[model samples]
Target: MTASPAFERLAIVGIGLIGSSLARAVRAEGLARTIVCADANADHAARAKAIGIVDEATTDPAEAAAGADLVMLCVPIGAYADVARTIGPALKPGAIVTDVGSVKQAVIDAVAPHLPEGVHLVPGHPVAGTEKSGPDAGFAALFPGRWCILTPVPGADEGATRKVADLWRACGMTVERMDPGHHDRVLAITSHLPHLIAYTIVGTATDLEEHLRQEVIKYSASGFRDFTRIAGSDPTMWRDVFLNNREAVLDCLQRFTEDLTALQRSIRRGEGDALFDLFTRTREIRKGVLDARQA
Candidate 1:
């Protein structure tokens, strides 16, 4: 219940799931003196304000960011540059700029140039979210016990990075510092590739004949339902993620394809031992993930 260092104002641009969740966390933990949010969708902005999650909400990024000590960009990766450009001139001197973007390198590239002198850029990803989106989908518990990776570029203000890290910790997240490229590579495998496979498999199932598709939906409880949940994630967010992390995702996809082809060959040849060994190995990996508390 300790209060976080007070910031005059904390601006969140994009009152979607992540943005609204941060607003709730900031308020619940008293991380900021004031929390303001903006969304391109007026309804979303109004909903955030009406829900009392944020102190103020607006439709303009500049208005939201004006004079704020911390300005967080919580929009789709594709919208980062435009939002950054819009809020750049409105940022107060010495303000810290951060983001909850899944992709790190793209965010840094998109926002760094527009920031004025003395402003800090701290790119971060909270490795926790549900498939659902929008302001109403958010809750204060979204961040607790989650990993919040901060990838601050060289020359970023140390104080600013620490302040952001502290804020996440105050919200019950464990903070980790990592290189942007490394963060992207790790997320490519852990998050991006999984989402891609889910999307692909779900899309393929949707292409089946009407009867088969109905049956697929009816009998989806085994494992297909999991994929459906992932595939159900916001289309705009996933699309921007793939476009922004193109190279890393493609690299992981290539490797995944090679491994899948090997498994297909084993199955076609009726190599029981090979299939058994592969499944056992993957099961061990699943165990490892569970043990690491990252599953």
Candidate 2:
């Protein structure tokens, strides 16, 4: 006999790259009996339905969330509070609310208070994506071989957390539990800081003299092209990420600045050994990433 779907209904808010991707994965894995989506962009919502990824689509989050057994927030972090407020009263008791936001503590802060009694909040980050957006950019293949980190707040229901983790596992992601605050700190260095540097580098290149800027793009090396790809991510989403995780991002930025200054001093002093040692260490880190199959 076929096993029952994990949830009776799954409502996904925000039909962007991540949201649509999850919808596709859930359908592919038969994780939910009914799948629906809500997007601030009515066109995007309609697009998701037209693509046949969702059973229903609407611009109102409350409408999508009502009676849903699982509510997944894939909206920008900046919009979390407003979305939470709109959907709070509509959510049914015993429903599980989870998110794919990069910063967990802030997500819990924005969402948990709005949830009614008996509802469970499990903040999650799928630790995966591409520099693409919109429903057409999504595929069920995106989640495979990626990590999904869940940060269930203190006092959160154990069963609810396990269900959320299992949902990701069904989509082919390895799952790990983390403290919300600790998750923020770890992601600050691993994901947030790298994006910040990429945006800065690309912004600098754009500010160069027109001729020089043209040449930079014309003869771009692999490194600069990679930075451009990172910088091409959704602007509104990244803006919220940096603002919501400011404390941790700023801390990492300061440390990065200190290290950069040290590297600058070494270069000025013609210390070849210093540069060589730093490069060797960084090369090993890259090797480690490959060894772990995360690269």
Candidate 3:
């Protein structure tokens, strides 16, 4: 016998990598009775319906959100406010509005005011994804063994929060709760800074002479290849992330610059022991991440 669904109806705004993956995961686990995907890009909505990832797909955010018990905003961070505004009136009473945005504080700040009084805002970030986009890039396996962080506002409905947590757990993720500001700062170091560095390194390579550029790609099986992969992430999404989480990302970037400068000095001075010690410490950090299966 099929078990009952956790959500009466789930509205997914922005059916890209994360959104599509959520639809797939929810369906696989029978977490939502109905999955409605809304993307401003008509092609995305059409493709989502065609692929049978969603019961319905629409370009109108409000229309998709009208009867949904849970509405997840999966668009870029910059679009949060606009989406919230559009869907504000459509959201039913006691509805739980969550998100898959990487930046947390900005999401709350942008989306909170627009939501109706009775609707609960529970922002979330599923800290798992690939350097891919669009409806076709998603899969149910993306949520398993991953972490899902929820940043509920003060005085948030406990039942609503638990419901959201249970949904993620059903999708095979470990759920965590945190303050949105702290989540942003933590993610800045763990996720955003790395992406920024990757983009910078890859962009630098793009400016290399034509001959050197070809050689770089030809022999990119080294670390440069990994950076290229990270840099290939959705441009609009990353741009919005950096813009939305500017304070946290800038803080982390400053510290990273200081560390990088020290490394550069050590290299210039031929301080092999200092470089070796630093590398050894970083190696341990990588090992710890691997142990945690977060890498």
Candidate 4:
């Protein structure tokens, strides 16, 4: 006998890279009996349908969410509150609401109150993405071997949480539960800060003399080219990410600034030993990440 689908109906509220990738993944895995998506961009909604991954597509989040067993807000963090409010009324009893945003604490703050009673919010971050956007950028292979973190609020329904976790597992993700605040703090350092630095470095290059800028691009090394790719991510989404997670990001930025100042002092004072020790420690951290990926 065929096993039951994880969800009777799954509604995704944004059809960009992550949303469309999820639709493809769910369909490929038979995780949902029906899949629907909404995008503020009408063309994106139409593209999602034309691609044949979703059963329905609409510009109205509420209409797509109506009767859905699982509603995933795949929009930027800045739009979370409005989308939650729009879909809250249409959510059926016991529906599970989740998200793929990077920031967790603010997502909970924005989405929790708007959900109807009996609806559970299990905020999640898929910790995987590319510097691409729009429906055409989606692929089913994005989730495999990636970490998906869930941050269920206090007193959240265990069943709903498990259902969502199972769906991610079926997509080939490793699941871990975390406190929302801690999730934000950790991401601020590992993800947010790196993106910020990339943007800054690329932006600085852009501000250089026209000749120097041309040379930089012409002779770009792998390091600078990688920074450009990170900096090329959707500007609207990154703006919202930095705004919505300002407190945590700012805290991390402050610590980073202090460390940077110390490094500058070490260089200015000709303290080669200090620089060597710092480089050695950071090299170990990079090795750890590589080892984990290999394992």
Best by lDDT: 2
Tens-digit lDDT string for candidate 2 (154-269): 88899999999999999999999999899999999999999999999999999999999999898878569999999999999999999999999999999999999999999999
Q: Rate the local accuracy (lDDT) of all candidates.
A: 0.93, 0.95, 0.94, 0.94
TM-score comparison, 3 vs 4, better candidate: 3
Among residues 3 or more apart in sequence or in different chains, the pairs in candidate 4 whose N, CA or C atoms overlap within 3 Å are none
Candidate 4's displacement at residue 159, Å, is 0.5
Against the hidden reference, what TM-scores do the models get?
Answer: 0.98, 0.98, 0.98, 0.97
| Global Cα lDDT for candidate 2 | 0.95
**Tens-digit lDDT track of model 1 for 151-184:** 9998878999999998899889999999999999
Which 10 consecutive positions of candidate 1 have the poorest summed lDDT?
A: 1-10
Question: Scored by Cα lDDT, where does model 3 land?
Answer: 0.94
lDDT score for residue 42 of model 4: 97
Q: How do these models rank on lDDT, best leading?
A: 2, 3, 4, 1
Better of 1 and 2 by lDDT: 2
- Model 4, 194-242: lDDT tens digits are 9999999999999999999999998888569999999999888899899
